[model samples]
Target: MNNISWRGIRAFLYVAEHGGFTAAAEVSGFSKANLSQLVTELEAALSVQLLYRTTRQLRLTEIGQGYYERCKIAMQQLDSAAEWASQSTDELRGEIRMNAVGGPVGEEVLAPLIIEFQRQHPGIRVDLDFSSIHVDLIASHYDLVMRMGELPDSTLIARRLHSVTTRYVASPEFVAENHEIAGPDDLKSLPLIRGSVDTWTLSKGKTRKTVHVAEGIKVTSGRVMRQAALAGLGVTRLADVYVQADLQQGRLTEVLPAWSEETQLTLVCPPLRHQLHRVRVLMEWLKAHFAERYQQALAEGPGQHFKSNLGAS
Candidate 1:
């Protein structure tokens, strides 16, 4: 036999099942003449007379009956396979590997949200890595990464989850002892707990200013910087999200609030085309969850310090 034609096989099956060329053509969208031609071609390919044709009617041969039965099963299986492949894309059933910083943003904010997300979507398994060191997403095959501050120009797609405003804060005891922090210039005189960056960028309305303060205690981690600030180890600029609770409880006092800098918290990932269904779902869930948490954090009292310009980009 020559190479089989699926088109001819489909036409033959339709004709045999529908009992006539006219009826089969109506259902299959093939013309009556085309249907007849396809059946003739199929018979020629098989080298057997599969149908008995006359002016009034048509009937399938015994061999044709057996062939139709087998073809029907094969076609049904093909349809099932196609359906399964399509459903795999729509259904959430995979693993998502993500990287984040090991601070309040990761442990206090994202970790709980991820746990809740996994509870909601039981099929998705999330692997979250927390470290201060940056990881190469493409090289490590990470599904996504959460980063703070200004994102450098790159091919990675960044979704701004929230805008983080930094406030220069100190313990109430420290502030009471060193009460010379009345303006931006006084920050230079006070003992400052410097993090990775030594310079502070502050903006008000249309005016922006940068101040280089003396570093009293140098730390690499934001959490440690915050802890140092909380322990009355001089003043430091920290994100409002990380210190909202402490500020509310009178543990820390906001100093020079008018000169705070606003940076962005972004979720960086590969392009949308490369993202799996579970990854997409998690991104959207994070956006919504973070937005709500951002609002709640602002609403929990000591409202004078925290700003509310939270939005997605």
Candidate 2:
């Protein structure tokens, strides 16, 4: 308590949240023995039991639980104070842990912007986490997530970065074989390429329909799906950004323009009434970065997905 170490506090906090020393160490970056030692010091200083550790379990002592609550509040306040001071300056600096879809923009557009931002402020650390899954901002502890479309929970702040269109596409060969197709109904007849992994709901207001679009070649990644569609395996739907290059070069055709859908490119933030300045800063950075990428995201997509599958039957 007197010779309080921030490292010890962080480790202790992670341990309290995760319910174990090993987990705390993994998250906060400390060896398990080191974390245990820190906790021992903390407990000795506070003169109170902080945790009850069993062979396979960890539980907070009554005093430890109270201490955790107070510590969490204190940590939030300190984080907020630091974030506010950083934001008040023109320079956006600090470690930003972000979640994003690991696509071309993340590599090409956002990454470069992040580099520039870091160069502008040498003190900041940018940790970008690319994941296909929707990241929980509070629980997973990401500063921001550059996401597409609407947020499930209304409480979240889904800041619109830009809007993008989704189009049904297929290779020239597939189009040649199914040239008779005219509309969304035609999708039922064309060889489809979606995994049964998720329920895709497509609608034009009152005519909402949840399409169970799993058939033909199944794939998990949108990049892979686009590749399959480009290889003439089947007609698949994709965001305009994914197939932009193909659409321009005629490697892929926008088969169902009538069924095309548009959604905003967004950065989702925590639902809290007042989020930390760091999260807010990242959100602003994303909006600015996307403004530059929007033109490309709208006009063209990434290079053709690993093309060798062109001969795919």
Candidate 3:
């Protein structure tokens, strides 16, 4: 019956099998009154008396004995199913769909992390999508997504992985041929590779400048933009993480060191997905990986310009 509860069934079975309410209460840690009431509720719901109770003894009726046997088998199966589900949660097994910004950061950084994660958790399969355009995580059925800049969707749960200090960079050859870029205004004089945004914003101390850079080649892909810069195409703005080696190895030159911008890399997921074991594990693993990396960098020296904001959500 609709009003019958599994708890009440369990209670009735305990009293029936143990042969007395007092014995069932002692074995199950349920008080005698509570056990009696539960069995009574079960009987009322079924419209059948299940127990013949007296001061000295409690016994199941003929119909009650038959019902008890059926309930016992069903309860055992239900218990096994519940245990299987609980054990499955302990096992890392599922596919996680993710969307990420396509660039060196995804290729050189995130790709390796995913690979290592797969190696550690061989059961978990990851479906990673790399793109320059922003896609809705919930609508796209993505289990997780990596985003740059501030997230506008307040409905999603997000954690700060790190912030990348951006730089205006050009290939060493391009820098040599072009006029000197002493300030933001000087950037307008040279050829510029436009990225996602048409305008570039830079800040120095308290002064902020927004310049509509002369577009030489416009592309949305950061990987392509980096390639263009590497091939001596033109000046472009890029995250330092993506081009740190290029600057250090003399392949690319930072155009304006004084003026700078930074972008936050956030790990985002739907609130419900964030509660999942696999998704939550991957998220925490990434956060820990970055936190350890940047902390180690900080330990190395003062010149390293990496900041981890793992504390912020």
Candidate 4:
């Protein structure tokens, strides 16, 4: 209806998407009473029952679902229009919500770059979510997500930042004990610091084989895996970037250098969000930053191990 407040529609949309008034309030910074009042106002204007609320759960009615579908589309268009209009202004002033892996990648890598970007573009703000949970870009309303390696099939755009070689490495003490190892098959018999995957695929030229890691120190974080490897816990597979200094200083020894696998770090963007100038700018900024590092690492020569395919499709 013409009298419907834009705020009311936005509040309603947030509640519907978040699946609860409490979640909507948390995300939208609206009080629960405020969200309820707005939704009530919206229902009064439209003269339709959009949501069924009970103590146990809240759900959209059939009519409400249809309305929500259309409203979602309209709101996305409105957001795009607002973004387009803002492009005319000299300063970029908005919030970019990003979902990324936490720990070293979030703190040591991305945090510094984001701080610098914000310094240069004073009007822009970043709301970076460092939750380790799986992310859905559109559903979660995230502007960007940083991910590593084998991405699942999705419609989102993934721009490569860098290609890093995965190395099977262990502490000097561990390597000393298992110095007889020479191939991918040797890894199966040794205790391994493993991630969630049960097997690791290694390639030497065109020859490839999958080694089953049955047991050992299990960890999810790359940083922890590195620590485990350094402690001589077991053999661990790590990206070159994580263990470069360790390899050079003899803290960790790379085993099966001939069987390393390559993985890429990428920034994923929703197609619609990628069209926005702010998101695109951030994407390019990250690409360029990583590109420079990749090049520098490459320039250090073969003795230094950086295999980057930055900006490569």
Candidate 5:
């Protein structure tokens, strides 16, 4: 309607997307009452009952669903037009929305990199969302997404930033107290701290096998798994990027090195055409960062057991 405001449209879209006024208010920076008022104003202007509300939940009416679909298209077009206009300038400015899996990757790797990127480009604003659930990049308006493990075929433009080798590691004390673990088969008897997965697939050249570990402690966080290993709770398999320092320091000793699995860490964008200059700069920075880290890892060499520490063990 001619009487409808962009604020009202945004409020309605956000509420509908988030499924409630309270959640929408959190993201839109509006008070819940204010958001409710905006939505009411929008409904009054459109002359339709858009939402069916209860004390506990909010549901969209049939007309509301149709309206939401049309509004989403219009909003996407407006966003594209704004992005296009902004791209005319060579100056790095505008917002970039990035999504990544939460935990070690988010806390240890991306958080610092994002802080550094913001410091370098004062004109650019970055929104980093760390969640285990994968969001639809195009529909959610995300500029980029970082993912790990095997990537299925997708229309999204995928770039392999780096491949991190997974290492089965445990504390040197734990390894010393327990009998020597000669190979993957020995892992069956050892206490294992499981993280996110119950099984690990190990490969040696063409030969590959999956070992279902006997779990001692189950954790969702990689950092927690490392901490558990440091405490000598059990063995764990984690990406080298996450445990490089621990390995180098001999806080954790690598077990079954020959069976380590390499998983590719990838960055995916909706499409090259949709990416802005700011997004491109961040992507390049990320690529360079990973490359440098990989080179450093190579230079550092595989983690070694200190002779003095081994003697004490």
Candidate 6:
């Protein structure tokens, strides 16, 4: 019809849904004056009243209410049809939604692979969500999450993509200045950069031990903790894969020689229509990148090192 337009229809839907021009204008990225005029023109074209406008408020008339309900369904169908078309290809093409905590995984692991992925399949779009806190994928409408810690209870599928390996870490220079810690107990009375928890559970082979560490300085982010450890602030437990390069190069020393070290980095995906190609492509890309980066970190430090710290603890 003459009144039909993607922008106008979309804007009309937004205003009708929110019951106001200002909010709809915000959603449409249009000035309120412009939106008002557009709606006025739309009603004239349709020869019907869409909204009952007053000085204090606006309410949808019969036509506006009917338009809104149908528009929502139409928009959903439009999005699904677009998704279906995008996923028809075996190649990665479509938007891939992701969320991850800050680390080598986000900066180092996923970042590099995305360039290659876009090059191979130009139609693909990646929206990365990076934050320190865990995200609720379904509630937040995130399609996938690359998580480093325990997965929360949900219907989303989870995949183990990287080993959760942690190790003892301190710079060689720090050790020289602070006096070398011979074992876990030697950390007692040291200026410890404590984590959120007191017990540092370390494992190598069949042995697993949780060392009670007192907090001398406390903040999140292993990268910060590693820097603090290097500055001779105190001992901190770090993911072995994260600090492996330093261990091999004499940059970071493995404080305890015998401790079990293994944890998990998981790939999480929402259950709805998840067999899509973009999800499959990103998952494989992550698995390969993490494997490569993990090996490189293990090779960097002494018996172990940051950057080159390799293998399980």
User: What are the root-mean-square deviations of the candidates from the true structure over C-alphas?
Assistant: 19.4, 6.4, 17.5, 6.6, 6.7, 8.2
Give the per-residue lDDT digits (tens) of candidate 5, residues 202-249: 789998777797758889877788889999998898878667778887
Model 3 weakest lDDT span, ten residues long:
301-310
lDDT of each: 0.78, 0.72, 0.79, 0.81, 0.80, 0.70
Sorted on lDDT, highest at the top, how do the candidates line up?
A: 4, 5, 3, 1, 2, 6
Once superposed on the true structure, which residue ranges of model 2 sit more than 4 Å away at CA?
1-14, 17-52, 59-74, 82-92, 152-158, 195-198, 270-282, 297-300, 303-313
Per-residue lDDT tens digits for candidate 3, residues 246-288, read 7777878998998868789999987667766888899999998
- The candidate that wins on lDDT is 4
| Candidate 3 Cα errors over 4 Å, as ranges | 1-87, 291-313
Q: Write the per-residue lDDT of candidate 6 for residues 65-156, one digit (tens) a residue.
A: 88777777667556655676656655556688778865665665566566667777788888887876768665454778887767766677
lDDT of 1 at 301: 27
TM-score (all chains, Cα) for each model? 0.61, 0.71, 0.62, 0.75, 0.72, 0.65
Worst 10 residues of 1 by lDDT: 304-313
- Over 23-137, each residue of candidate 4 has an lDDT whose tens digit, in order, gives 9999999999999999999999999999999999999999999989888877876786677766744557788899886654565467657888999888889988898788866
| Model 3 global lDDT (CA atoms, 0 to 1) | 0.79
Tens digit of per-residue lDDT, candidate 2, span 228-303: 8878898887777788778888888887576678887777765441355555766677677767665655454664
Summing lDDT over every window of 10 consecutive residues in candidate 5, give the lowest-scoring window.
300-309
Clashing pairs in 5: none
lDDT of 1: 0.78
lDDT by residue (1-313, candidate 1, tens digit) is: 3556888989998999899999999999999999888889888988888899999999999999888878876765564445445647767877788888766667656776898899999998999999677776544457789988877748887788988778889999999998668777787777899888889767788886677967588898777887898899999888787677788789899988888788788888865313456777898899989877665654452332223323221
Instruction: Please report the TM-score between candidate 2 and the true structure.
Output: 0.71
Which pairs in model 2 have colliding backbones?
Answer: 94-124, 244-301, 245-301
Sort order, TM-score high to low: 4, 5, 2, 6, 3, 1
Better of 1 and 5 by TM-score: 5
* Residue 169 error, candidate 4, Å: 0.2
